[model samples]
Target: MTIRPIVRYPDPRLALPAQPVTVFDGALRELASDLLETMHAAPGIGITAPHIGISLRVVVLDLDPVDGARTYVNPEIIWASPEMILHQEGSVSMPGVNDDIRRHARVRIGYRDIDGNAQTEESGGLRAVCHQHEIDQLNGVFWIQRLSRLKRERLVKRFEKLSRG
Candidate 1:
């Protein structure tokens, strides 16, 4: 697996919705592998295809590098618990910029495995936050959208400042 370059924030591709994965084949598996390598290299717990400019409905996540990674194709959140929690969130695409964001404490999600099998699972804590965050990216919704207007504005300004430097 090769580590692919992650598209940084302000890239138009990161704001676009990803296309669904139709064929589950060797290439799909390779992409998943590459995604895992890339996400690990980013030192991030979660990453989506759009973050790397692939524009496919794929996500790879592994909170602990020693535990292996998970690939999600066409992932969709099926249910979310009423309880919410705030977690500090950052993006590989927008490194060095992060803010506490509110997310469902627990979530049930449906997705396709690399072998073309349909899979469903529930997750909580950082895993839940990661899924919700990556799913939002698949839908072209960046995490900062969950923030209030003031925070969003501040983040954008900071990104702009970084670009200038």
Candidate 2:
């Protein structure tokens, strides 16, 4: 697996909706492997296909080293609880900037495995937050877009400064 360059923030691709994976083949597996490597290099807990200029609906998450990694294909949120939680959300695309964003405390998502098997996961806490965050990205809604206008502007400025320095 190769570590691919992450697509930076404000890139038009990050705002474009990703297409569902139509074929589950070796190339798909390789892409997932590459995503894991790239996420690790980015030092991010999660990443999506669009994060690396791949317009496919795939996500790789490794919240715990012990748990290893998980690949979600064409993931869609099937359910979300009314309870909300505030979690600090950042992106591999926009490194060095983060903000607490409100998200569902619990979520259930349906997705396919790398081998094309269907899977559903119910999660709470950080896992739930990740599910929502990455799924939003697949829908072309960057994490900062969920922030208040003032907060989004401030975070973008901070990211810009970091990029320059």
Candidate 3:
């Protein structure tokens, strides 16, 4: 598996909605493997296919090193708890910036595994936050888009300065 360069923010492809994965074959497995490797290298908890310029609805999350990684293809949020929680979120695409974004404290998502098995799972806490964050990217919703206008502008400026340095 190889680590693909993560597309930085402002990349047009990052804003475009990802297409669903049509076939679950060896190639899909390989892509998933590569994405996992990339995510680990980024030292991030989750990553989406579009993070590496692949516009497919794929997400990998490895919240705990001991628990192994999980992949979700064509994931869709089926249900979200009414209660919202504020969690600090960031993207590999836009590093060096983080802010508390409000999201559902718990979520249920439906998707297929790499084996093409349909699955639905509910998650809470950091796991839930990570899933929501990555799933947003799959739906063309960048993390910063969840922030207020002023916060978004400040994040942009902060990212600019970090990149320059």
Candidate 4:
């Protein structure tokens, strides 16, 4: 597996909605592998396909230190609780910026495995927030979108300055 370059913020592709995966085959598997490698290289717990410019409903997560990687194809949040929790979240695509965002404390997600088998899992805490964050990227939503208007403007200005440099 090769580490793919993450498409940074302000990249149009990061804001564009990804296409659904119609054909689940070797290419998709390779994409998952590459995503894992990229996530590991970034030292991040989660990654979405759109972050790498693939624009597909795919994500890789490895929140556990011992367990193997978790690959999700066409992941969808099935259920979310009303109870909200604030977590300081960061993204590989947007380095050096962390935002405290409110998200569902618990969520049930459904998605397809690498073998084309359907799977559902319940998660909470950092895992839940990370999963939801990455899934949002699959739909072209960034964590900055969850921030207040002033914070969003500040982040955009920071990113703009970084780009200028």
Highest lDDT against the true fold, candidate: 2
Name the runs in model 1 displaced over 4 angstroms: 163-165
Worst 10 residues of 1 by lDDT: 61-70
Candidate 1: residue 52 Cα off by (Å)? 0.9
Model 2 TM-score?
0.99
| Clashing pairs in model 1, backbone N/Cα/C closer than 3 A | none
List model 4 lDDT by residue over 27-140, tens digit each.
Answer: 889999999999999878889998888879999999887877899888899999999999998888987778799999999999999888889999999889988998888888
Error of 4 at 69 (Å): 1.7
lDDT of 3 by residue, 99-158 (tens): 999999999999999998999999999988988999999989999999999999999999
Error (Å) of candidate 1 at residue 112 is 0.7
Q: lDDT of candidate 4 vs native? A: 0.88
Candidate 3 worst ten-residue window by lDDT: 60-69
Task: Return the clash pairs for model 2, or none.
Answer: none
Question: Which prediction has the highest TM-score against the true structure?
Answer: 2
Error of 4 at 120 (Å): 0.7
Model 4 bad stretches (over 4 Å): 161-165
Model 1: per-residue Cα lDDT over 1-165, one tens digit each = 999999988788887999999999999999999988898888788888898889899999987658688899999999999999999998999887899999999999999999989999999999999999999999999888899999999998997787688
- Cα-based lDDT at residue 115, candidate 1: 92
Clash count, candidate 3: 0
Candidate 4, 77: how far from true, in Å? 0.8
For each of the candidates, the C-alpha root-mean-square deviation to the true structure, in angstroms, is 1.3, 0.6, 0.7, 1.4
Against the true structure, candidate 4 reaches a TM-score of 0.93
Give TM-scores for every candidate, taking all chains together and pairing residue i with residue i. 0.94, 0.99, 0.98, 0.93
